[model samples]
Target: MIISNIAAPLLGLVDTAIIGHLPQSIYLSGVALGAMITSFTYLLCMFLRMTTTAEIAHAFGARRSDLAQQTTTHAVVIAAVLGLAIILLRPVILQLAWAVIEPDPELQRYASQYIDIRLWAAPAALINLVVLGILLGRQQAKYAMGLVIFTNAVNVVADIILIIGLDLNVVGAAWASVLAETSTAALGLWLIRDLLPPWRQWHITPAYFKQFGAMNRDVFIRSLLLQFCMAVMTGYAARFGAVTVAANAVLMQFLMLISLGLDGIAYAIEALLGAARGQGSRHKIRLWMRLCALWSLLFACAYSVVFWGFGDGIIRLLTDLPEVIQTAKLYLPWLIIMPLLGHWSYYFDGVYIGLGLTRAMRNTMAISVLGVFVPTWLISQQWLAEEHANHGLWLALSLFLLARGVTQWFYLKRHQRRLST
Candidate 1:
């Protein structure tokens, strides 16, 4: 699971590596901005994955085979509709992003080019998310992991061929992702063919639809806020200059690597907890949480140490540009501090997913983003000079993570009280 999860971020790392070595920093900057926008958009629909997993996991755990089948059917249908909607509405989405990001003409040209090409794969990309959730929800970790590895392997190979061998640059990178996603969705459907009910057997019930909408609504809002925070960071980075954007992009790849790897533990927790919840085993659920927390804390510490000790060496490997490297090094301290502050949220996120506490998750994320992240960002900007905007951005992000974990803990405690009473 960890290996597969880590490979997902390797796509970003590969893109940065290929584009970073381009003749000009503008190429890297353009791809970075475009990629962030695409990522945010895709993640905004991540309710498909998160909610599907929760629904299917509970159904599977309770041995409700019919309900499990129905959930999968509904999930796929929802993904298809949402994916098509994104494709049709992409122009509006792009326009809104452009207004907020406000990139220069050169950056705008490259970003628009990348986004336009990538948007065509929306249906395939969304179905892939549902497939992933279904597989993991059934506790098919090896299979889920295999699919992730397969998709990313194709992506990496395509990236090298298109970006370097053909010199296709940013367009090549976007096409590589599109091809990878479309292929993976096809492969996923084939793998789960037997598990999915036949068309005649599959029918959506209003009761199921209501549950689906309710669950997805909470997760959708939570995901929107989470992605908004990240999108805002990149948007703000663009304000500093292409060099700053490029530097932050490089650092973001490293952060993605860490987060995705740790997410494996969280993913496992989700499956286990979901099953436990379905079984109504309080003791088992608490035990799983405690053990996962210990292991996660140790992993978090190791990540912090690695970043603190090897930050410079890693920065050099990410980009050849002296200016980007220098700027990244200047901001290395925040990266080192981030793992410690943010790791808890990752664990709690898995817990919430498993227990189907998404409304609580939604509420916590709302408070964190609206109450903690925005205020802290505004204050940090005023307190620090313009030259230190990157520092302020990182600070705001760190606080957001801290708030998410803290707020979730409060909710969890309240939930426990209700259960106990």
Candidate 2:
């Protein structure tokens, strides 16, 4: 799980390194913003991946091969449908992003170029999400790791050849990702053939359909709310000008790397927690939560130090642009502080999912979005308009992290007590 999560950002690191060296800063900013747009879109369907693992793992623990097969079929069907929907809605989505971010004309053009090419890979990307989830559920961690590594390795090489050798610019980066993801999806299908039932038996029964529908609806709502918050945050970043947006983008990569790496541990907890939940082992549930919390804090602190001490140098190595570097430096503290507050929220999310507390997760996130995120963002925007706008953006984002963490922890503690009683 660690290697799987790290491979993603490592792919971004390659793009950052290559694009950062381009002769112009606009291209760098363009790629960063473009990538963010793609990520936001892709992650909206992330529950396809997450829910699959949780459900399949639970089913596997119960020795229900039929249910596991049904889960895989449902996940694949949902992913394909969602992927198609995204492709169809590409124009509307991009238009909304443009309206919100309002990038410079040149940057906008580059963004469109990147999005246009990458959009074609939507089906493959979503399918890959389910594929990875199924593999993780089967406890094929090494295979899962290999699939991600293979995809990103291809991406890095393709990125270098397209961007540096062929001068395809931003489009090159996008194309590289599309190709890499497609390869990963194909390879993933081949690897997990044993887990899949025969093609003749692949049909969703009425009862199975009802359960799958419920899972899809619950998980989709949860993911949509999360993605909406992220989109709003990105919009705020974009409002601050290209350099500010670019700086935040670069800082975002670090956050992704750290958050996702920690998510590996969370994934482990989800698997264990789901299995315990299946067996109705309350003691094991508590044990998983405690161990995850302890490890989460330790990892968060270690990541914070790495970000504080080595982050600037890492940014400098990515790009030689003085302005971008300077902009990133001002906001470096947020990057360091983020893991401390943010990691717990992610960890708790896995725990909640394992306990089949999707409704609680959804409700807590909605409340945070309404009561915490919106008000804090509005206040920050007001302050920015008054003076020192850039600082206001960072402040707003930091508040979002703190709020999310606090609220999630609150709910989880309550849930823990309820379970105890």
Candidate 3:
């Protein structure tokens, strides 16, 4: 899981490197802009993956092969529909995305070309999410790992061949991703052939949609909240000027690294806990919780130590700008300790997803985002000097994460009696 998570991000780095080799900087900027849109739209739809994983895991735990099969079918259908919707709405999406971004005409042209090409694989990319969810839910870690590697491998090769060999430039980079996603989706379907429902047996009723929508509503909100907070952080950081914003970007990468490593563990927990909860096995659920906590804590501690020891060095490696590096160091402490405070939310997230208690997650996130994080930052802007305004922003974010974990903890405790029974 960790390797797959880590490998996923490396694809972006590779893409950037490939595009960076171009003589003109516009190619890189264009691809970057298009990729940002890809990230945002896909992010909003991530709930499909989590909800599907939960459904499959629960069904598996309960020994309901029929339910598991149905879950996969349902997810594939929804992913297809959503992906198609994205394709059809591509024009509107581009206009909306560009409105906020507002890049130059030349860069916009390059990015639009990339986006137009990339949208061709929207259906495949979205379906791949459910395919992965199915694989992970079955605890087929090796298969999941292999699929990720396969996709990345295809992408890397295509990027080299089309971008370098054919000199397709930005278009080649876009096509690489499209090819990778489309081919991987096909491979994923083949890999999960056993789980696919037969034509005569397939059924997707309104009840399924209703239940699925209910299950995913909170998850969707959670994704949106996370995205909003990220945008808010970036927007707020921009207030301090280019150097501070750049530093925040660098620091944000650190947070992403932390989340990626921890999320690998969370995924495992989701599967384990979901299966256990499905079976109503209190003992198994308790055991998984205790075991996951120990390991996740160990991993979180390692992140803190690495950041504490080499945070500045990592910053320097990311950029040669001394000002950005220096500014980033000023807030490095928050990044260093963030793992300790932030791991709980990630941990509890797995728990909630496994138990299929997204409403709890939704409520806690609302409180964390609106009740705690926003208020803290708003107060800080007025209370703290301009020089230290970013400090308050950091403080709000840290507290926001901590608040999520804490609130979820309370949720678990509040319902412990019912759950254990």
Candidate 4:
């Protein structure tokens, strides 16, 4: 899981490297801005992935294969509808993004070019999310890992061939992602062909949608809150000028890389805890939580040490732009400290998803974003000068992670106490 997750972010790293080395830095900034917005939209729809994983895992634990199958089918259907809706509303979405991100006109043009191409893959991408959820739910981590690794491997190769070989630039990057996602979706379906319901046997009823709607509503809101924080970070960075946003893009990639690596353990926790919860094994759930936390702590410390020692070289590897490199250096300390500060939140996310305690998840995110992060950021802006505009953003992000992890811990302990009683 860790290996495959690492490969996933390396695709983004490849994109950043490809564009960062271009003669103009605008290409890199434009792609970064566009990708952030794209991620925001997809993440808002991420309930398809989380709820599917939780529900299917629960069904598997309860020995209800039929329910598991139905869960995947319903998730895919919902994903398809939402994906198509995104395509249909592209104009409005772009207009809204333009107002929020406020990219420079040239950067906006390049970003729009990339977004136009990539949006077509929405249906494929969302369906693939369901495929992954099924794979994870069934305790088929190896298959899920293989699928992710394969998808990223294809994406990297296509990105090189189209972007560097054909000189297609940003357009090539977008097309590369589109081809990769669509092809992977097909591969995922083929890989799970036996597990999927036969076309003739498949039936959708109002009850299925109702169940899905109920399960996903809280998950959707949780995801929206999370993604909104990210959007605000990216949007605010763009307001600081292209250099600030570009440098932030590089740093954010570092954060993503770390998150994905840690998520390997988180994914394991989700599977284990979900199954345990399904079977009413509170002891098993506690065991998984303890073990996952221990591993997460060790990994987080190791990453922090590595980032602190060799962070500069990593930045150089991402971009050749002198300004971007220097700007990234100014905020390098945050990257060093972030893993230890932020990793607990990532671990908590997996536990919450596994337990399907999404209302708690939603509440924590609201408190972190609105109650803690935003207020802290506003305060920081007043005290700091305009040149260090991003200091507050970084501070807010750290505080948000800390708040989330702490809040989740409180909730989990309370639940455990009640269970014991």
> Could you estimate the TM-score for every candidate?
0.97, 0.95, 0.86, 0.97
Q: Please list the C-alpha lDDT of all candidates, in the order they appear.
A: 0.87, 0.79, 0.81, 0.84
Q: Which ten residues in a row have the lowest lDDT in candidate 3?
A: 4-13
**Candidate 1 per-residue lDDT over residues 21-108, each given as its tens digit:** 8889998998889889988888888889888888778877898887777888898888888889989988998899899988889998
The candidate maximizing TM-score is: 1
Predicted structure with the largest lDDT when compared to the true one: 1
User: Which model, 3 or 4, shows the larger TM-score?
Assistant: 4
Segments of candidate 3 deviating more than 4 angstroms: 6-8, 16-34, 98-117, 159-173, 199-201, 235-247, 316-331, 378-393, 418-421
Q: What lDDT tens digits, residue by residue, belong to model 2 across residues 1-421?
A: 6776654556556677788889888788788877777878888777787788888778867778877888888888778888888889899978988988887798899888888778788989998988888877776789989998899889988998999899998988989988998888889888877767788877778897787667667767877877667666555677677777777777777777786768888787877887787777788888988998899889999999988889988888888888889988887887888888788777877887677777777777777777877777777777666336666655656666667678878987787688669
Which tens-of-lDDT digit does each residue in 1-421 have in candidate 3? Answer: 6655544355455565677556564565566556656656776787887898899999989899988887888888889999999999999988986676555677678878988888878889888888888887888989988988899999999999999999998899889988888998999999999988787877787887789888878899998887667655654554566466556766776887887778888888899998998898889988999998888899899999999999988876655556766888999999998999999998898888988889988889898999988999899999999999998988999999999989999989988977557
Which sections of candidate 2 miss by over 4 Å? 385-387
Candidate 2: the clashing residue pairs are none
What are the per-residue Cα lDDT tens digits for candidate 4 across 1-421? 5664553355567788888998889889988888888778777887887788888889888988878878877787788889999999888889999987777899899989988888898898888878877888778888888888888878889988998899999999888888878998899889777667888877777887787787689888888888877777777888899999999999998898787768877777888889998898978988999999999999999999989989999999889999999999999899899889988998998999899888888888888889998898889888989997798899988888889899888988897788679
Rank ordering of all candidates by lDDT, starting from the highest: 1, 4, 3, 2
List candidate 1 segments past 4 Å from native. none
